[model samples]
Target chain A: MRKSTIIVLALFAALFLAGISAGEPERVLDQAIRICLSCIGIG
Target chain B: MMERVRRLVQVVFTFLTNGYWAFPFSRNIYQGPLKAICSPGLNCYSCPASTTYCPIGAIQQLMAGLRMSLEMGQLYLGWYVVGSIGVLGGLFGRMVCGWLCPFGMIQELLHRIPGRKFDAIPGLLRYLKFAVLALMVVALPLFAVDEFGAGDPWFCKYLCPAGTLEAGIPMILLQPDLRHTLGWLYVNKIFFLVLFVVWSVFANRPFCRTTCPLGAFYGLFSRVKMVRLSLDEERCTECRACHQVCPMGVRFNENPVDTNCITCLRCQKACPYGAIHLEAGGVRLGARQSRPAQAQSS
Candidate 1:
């Protein structure tokens, strides 16, 4: 039980870290979405 | 004669590379009809640097760039793209998966390499693609994020064997500098290509059969749509030859619906009892259909 819990936690942590580390280009997408939404009043 | 002309024109304008010298067939004139083929699948937006736009990639670029001005008036539309996908699917289902998809063409070319052959994904796991289609492709992007998240390139990013083959490898190859700048995206693309190609040796397009978001989209009208596969149960002799030939695991003897079938014409030829037919509305005939010759349709 303890080993499985650790593995799952590690997997999720890795996913989160990977997203963060994907750097600016990946996040630039988020900014673009926000800008587009704002243009239409939702941003 | 007109239909043949349409198809010939479609081929000439849509093809990326050709040995022909007849005035560069893949130009703007091919745009209208070929858009049906191009829009429904995740074909590359940048290739031939297209005269039009790929809604999936365009939507993504919009989302990534934050451009959502969907009002009563606009240039192109999500609903139009959705309708095209549905119309094509209802009319042909996986036929599009087999014959017209740019990505499927690439996978078929790879399958023809030296020694590897084809196989089917097992029935139990085929459900995984639906999950990806529903959750990752639609729900996560269209609903879960922002007031409306941008469209997800679910197939391109996660399940697309073709994207890796076409975009990932070529992009990396062309940019000698980008190869030195190797990152996770490049690695993931390679990983996806290797896994999908390896699976193809055992199962004929496990990705298409199971997890292709585009296949899932077309499957909505697979059986009862304007165009579909016809099963003549009266003629069936319980011969599993159709089953043996089917890469998608549908049974003609059981009189299955056509939506999931790709209309590849293999079963039309495979059924010794003549039980299978590709039909649009009431029309029926099946020889020289191309998808079976290529791995995507069968």
Candidate 2:
């Protein structure tokens, strides 16, 4: 793999870990568990 | 053989990612532990059968709540979505589009319906996806807020035919109560859904090439992705065979790492001279296999 690819992957992996540590996954789950009425084009 | 494998993989992933089968009885979306993770493809989280979140939808939600999150001191509200997307991009670039996207598979299947096909996509129009990614998915969600300080998922609301097809249509059909809730926006979304569906029949992956923001995001990592297409320049005779076979209009012999390439490996299969090959981390995949030398001397 190229050095750039490794760097990009590592950087993103760190960000992912940070986001998880910050409880973003739970936040995502909270939003996803509900039926997104707007996504269905409902008012 | 590779095409069959690709199709099988597509089918498997499609079913696996959207496997919440109780929707038929419950008429409700999945509310489970798996909802924490986003699907690698563009499957809508609102789809009753969907087991995971849609990355684009999740990102828009976070972006829409950016101001609110900042005030609440939640700094990494959107980081997971962005990071996951970047990690996917860095690993395989648009390979996810060719091999994993249910919508891309749908478009390909539609294109194969034995109709009058047109492959001549406008060169400049290809960049529209990037614009959609920037404005609809990111900018609008961040900047356009209401009195409650939350913004709408502009791409999901006004665009994203995938959501309309996978979530809107199915949810409304299952739950009759949603029928009265439908209005102009519903019709508007259906129009987009129909437009893309019809366009897919006439062209190859028109949505992926022209307007899919997720595909656009992954395409950004085309040059630096770990798994990529490698072209043997010495073996290539500039016959344009790869160009003719490329569904995304990528001229592989000329620009091996073009952002448009989904790395579907159709070019690799089409190169009778064995000029194109798939590579992972600089090592050629399936190196043990030998390609037919039909056009080697030509």
The number of the candidate with the highest lDDT is 2
- Per residue, candidate 2 scores C-alpha lDDT tens digits across B1-298 of 9999999999999988899999999889999999988788999999999998999999998999888988888884688888898899999999999999999999999999996989879999999999999998899999999987889899999888999999999999999998998899999999999999999999899999999999999999988999999988868888899999999999898899888899888998888778888889989888633544654555
TM-score of chain B of 1: 0.72
| Residue-wise C-alpha lDDT for candidate 1, range B66-165, written one tens digit per residue | 3343442322323334444544554556676666665555455555566755465566676676777667655555544454534544444554555455
The 10-residue segment with the lowest total lDDT in model 2 chain B: B288-297
Candidate 1 yields a Cα-based lDDT of 0.50
The list of candidate 1 runs beyond 4 A from truth reads A1-43, B1-37, B47-77, B112-118, B143-155, B176-181, B286-298
True lDDT of residue B118, candidate 1 = 49
lDDT of 1 at B210: 72
- Per-candidate TM-scores read 0.65, 0.97
Candidate 2, what DockQ? Answer: 0.85
